[model samples]
Target: MPKTFYQFLMTQRNPESYDTIANFANNAFLDSAFPKQETEFDPLSKYLEENAPYLPSMTIFDDAWQLYLASLA
Candidate 1:
């Protein structure tokens, strides 16, 4: 698997909301708030909800996350 978000993409081929999505994930990872080992469900979605009060709206997170996943395909 990729080590970092940048490495994961390995290219600029992403949707318009890619940066926003990546920023959140990278920050969450860097801040030790991302549950990297959680296998029961989607970590990104969980992180976004857990940090909703401290970050932007869930709509943005949801959109960006979906776009990011699409870009990976």
Candidate 2:
């Protein structure tokens, strides 16, 4: 059997990680556009707007990975 898109993405190497970061950023923006409810930290629109400045820098997989780790702490 062949690897699916998700499987391929998960197994990507070095420079290919940048592409995965881009895809994750795109999906996050799309999902946040139509959020189910709103709250202080949960306000999708505001969160997206505030994070817009970081988008360009986020193109790097390492930066995006760090951001994800920071969010968890």
Candidate 3:
């Protein structure tokens, strides 16, 4: 069977919880209070690292929209 997006994200071993952090950052981008400058990326990254420490455990809850788009080819 093919690996689901959640499975792919879960299998990432480096940076430990990058997928989780990425998800949080993506959500922040949709918020009205989200910063428009690139400089805010680091702060958001830190926030996810600190607040969502169990990002890996929540893998199934996160959807891989980008992966779905890539599959259209």
Q: After superposition, how far is residue 37 of candidate 2 from its true place, in Å?
A: 14
Residue 3 local lDDT, model 1 = 38
- Which 10 consecutive positions of candidate 1 have the poorest summed lDDT? 2-11
Off by over 4 Å in 2: 1-18, 33-63, 67-73
Candidate that would win on TM-score: 1
Candidate 3 runs further than 4 Å off = 1-18, 38-73
Give the alpha carbon lDDT tens digit for every residue of 1-70 in model 2: 3332223323333433456565555554444443323322335335545654434443344544454445
Residue pairs with backbone overlap in model 1: none
| Residue-by-residue lDDT tens digits, candidate 1, 1-73 | 4233333322433334447555554455455544544422266567657764534666655665455466656
Give the distance in Å from residue 28's predicted Cα in candidate 1 to where it truly belongs: 2.2
Candidate structures ordered by TM-score, highest first: 1, 3, 2
Sorting all predicted structures by lDDT, with the top scorer first, yields 1, 2, 3
Comparing 1 with 3 on TM-score, the higher-scoring candidate is: 1
Please estimate how well model 1 matches the true structure, expressed as its whole-model Cα lDDT.
Answer: 0.49
The alpha-carbon deviation from the true structure for residue 46 of candidate 1, after best TM-score superposition, in angstroms, is 3.2
Tens-digit per-residue lDDT, 1-73, candidate 3: 4444333433333443455545544444344443333223246345445555444543322343354335434
